[model samples]
Target chain A: MEDVEAQTHLIGDSGEDPIISKIALAEVQRAIDSLPQEQREVLALVCGEDLTYREAAEVLNVPIGTVMSRLARARRRLVEMTAAA
Target chain B: MSELHLTDEILMAFADGELDQPVAAAVARVMAQDPAVARKIVEFQQSRRLTRSVFANNLAPDVPSELRAAISAKIEAYEAAVEGGEGKQAKETKSIWGGGMSPVRMALAASLAAVAVSAAYFIGQHSQSEVGRLAQLEHPRVLQELSRLESGRDAELPFGRLRVISTYRLPDNSLCREFRLQSTSTSTDAVACRTDGWRVTFALSDPAKGAEYVPSSGGDLLESYLDNLGAGNPLEGEAEAKALSETAR
Candidate 1:
């Protein structure tokens, strides 16, 4: 039940900000509420599982390099966003 | 670091532990020598951790057992149709999932299909390049073999080799097997029970110790799990064959 949302609807990519600022769940959830409906829908299917870059690309229907690039960009963005918080 | 000239993509992939053995090894050497490079890798790991933590926090209170059941039923139906042959395809595929479905239902259905595709992809990958490596129990041939393989003898398949060390019948009469999966880089000892499928109940990865039977190290863990299952004695010869034959049915 703890990860029911993570399990059922992987409907990310609706532009929702999956924030994890150190402040609190309330604030972090507020950020998630602000994200687009599809951001969360965009393939978070591979989370918690060990997927190769090629595997992740196939899951997302993106190129392998595109997978790496998004991973790079998303990780950096997460760092900056949390740092600023 | 400058000489290695590692790209962000490479670094990110390495941080994700997705790089192949050789490339990931190279990245590790560089990280060991350079603090800045190491920090960059750590940053990527931290970001991933944070994201997962947020997901853990926001999980819905109730398990979506209904959704899981629907998705599983759809998959079973699809597999049944595929196995039943080509003539009845349109009939079974349409009624189960293809009516006037809502947009949300459509997305859920699509995502569920994607998960199945991911499994197919694992098997597809195994068939082409994994004969010597025991990565996953995804191949049907492997499952079929598990159903009949006797203890002591092992089978070498294109996907990998599997050895059934022993078989057991629980107090409730369910059949279970203790087996090992061997590859070039590692070997895994596991226990799987007969159900709708061979469900893995326990697994432990061991360092690559060649294909030859390494005598038990005496500190085995799976032995105890079997002990708890009330497995009295391992079946052998006619008894073993009978147990396995019955399970395959």
Candidate 2:
């Protein structure tokens, strides 16, 4: 039971800053929160799987240019929000 | 260096590894040396990692037995409805899922319908001078095919062409469509649809995989094409039959 409980709550033994993790989590949430559904999806797919622009474009059924445009827009929003915070 | 105004999309794409090697390399050089852009990139990456961790556990959680049972029941009901022989009309009515449709299956049904309706007539219509005149008749056809495929299960429909290998509907109303292009490794397939056409979307392909799904924009734009045709409220009688007539060929 003790071993099982420890395993369940484990965040790994790395002593890295929880503060950075917290910041990252907050930033990601914020970036995605205000985004239109399509932008949020683009962020999720591009970021989540690390796909290339062409790949993302094909999967999303948009032109590569559109994919680039959306990513650019999404990134700008994140930067602005982070700056505001 | 001219201020290097990094757009959010470029920075995100860079962070997400979406840029091509040459372009990506160029961006990398800029990011490494450019303080403002680098800082922006890190923030987004951090967010991605955090959000993923937050919901990663949900991916593995056992779908509630009741929810699973409900889905199973829906599937059985759908099958029974199909077997009843209402044909294409019945399929569309049964498959036209709005709030009631499963998100995962909705995209498959919707995309299948979209692809079928949009592809058949529209493929030849483009680059033709008569494109504008044909648009009026084409829109209804897409909707009708969706209904027919959804309700009637037409033998001539292209739903059978594309193979839907897997599907999943998140607790949230996001429908995922995963398919392999018919008879071609060169083509890859995926689409995500929302409650209304307002939110219909697709995934990005794998860059290394090349143009896996080189989709021709069918007759209508895949995302916006379904705008008028919400689930359940399919075109009726002749309108529905006329729409599906092209696919029967």
For model 1, report DockQ. Answer: 0.19
- Given candidate 1, what's the lDDT at residue B203? 49
- lDDT of candidate 2 over B105-126, digit per residue (tens): 1111233322322222222223
Clash count (model 2, backbone only): 28
Expressed as tens digits, the lDDT of each residue in B46-71 for candidate 1 is 45444443444442122245643544
Best by lDDT: 1
Candidate 1 residue runs with Cα over 4 Å from true position: A1-43, A48-50, B1-3, B59-249
The DockQ score of candidate 2 comes to 0.10
Candidate 2 chain B weakest ten by summed lDDT? B204-213
